[model samples]
Target: MGQSAIGTKMITQIGILVHDIEAVSEAYANFFGVDKPAWNWTDTPDKAQTEFLGEPSQARAKLAFIDMDSLQLELIEPDFHPSTWRNYLEEHGEGPHHIAFVIEGMKEKIAIMESKGMKLQQKGEYTGGRYAYFDSIPQLKVLVELLENDK
Candidate 1:
């Protein structure tokens, strides 16, 4: 096999979309014998600078993170806004949304994925980092998210 286009094999997070974040997060915590985590909303569009399908979007979602040994399991409940999360939930119902990897060079990595025919879907900034999602379902059976944290 050739070098990975994203240049990383470590999947840092698995994002799952649900209709109710609190209910689902509690269920997961109980199932895993861990404490239910507090859920928070993604930053607003003004702070996140969110874009969906190359256009500015005001999408947001409730997010909860459950920490495991090597990766975190994320539960997402999207708002009515137009975003990858909302679209996936409406079209496919609740289920796994994307697998994320920690990375550097956000722009270059995005370009690499695009070269491989994976169209960029959504991107946004967070408090200490930024994220980009690629439409990788046709190739990987799931969306791919790249997280680049500031040093």
Candidate 2:
């Protein structure tokens, strides 16, 4: 097969949205035969940096990242808020939510996805990174998360 419209983004995360991050992360650890994630945190979008479909949104989630050889496995639990995770859970239940890519050329990547007719579903920034989710459900069967992290 040829290349996709989204281009060759280096995937960095396999993201899963669950009802309970701690419970599911532990389950994933056992299933994958690895220890639980060493990196874990919570994100509550600061209103100033968060947008859902270009509008402001109050989204919160608990996140955990398990270190793999090449890529990281990400676990997320939707807090009681308006967010992609909450929507996914309500519509599809807990499961794989999105695949994430960490890229350096953030603007270029976003433009590529936009050129492909993908809509920005969610976007926010954290300490060392910015993340955006694109509406790629029909083609990829899930949303695509673009991550640009300095750390």
| Cα lDDT of model 2 by residue, 87-111, tens digit | 8889998888999877767778888
Q: Give the TM-score of each candidate.
A: 0.98, 0.86
Which stretches of candidate 1 lie above 4 Å from their native place?
none
**Given candidate 2, what's the lDDT at residue 3?**
73
- CA lDDT, every model vs. true structure: 0.95, 0.79
TM-score of 1: 0.98
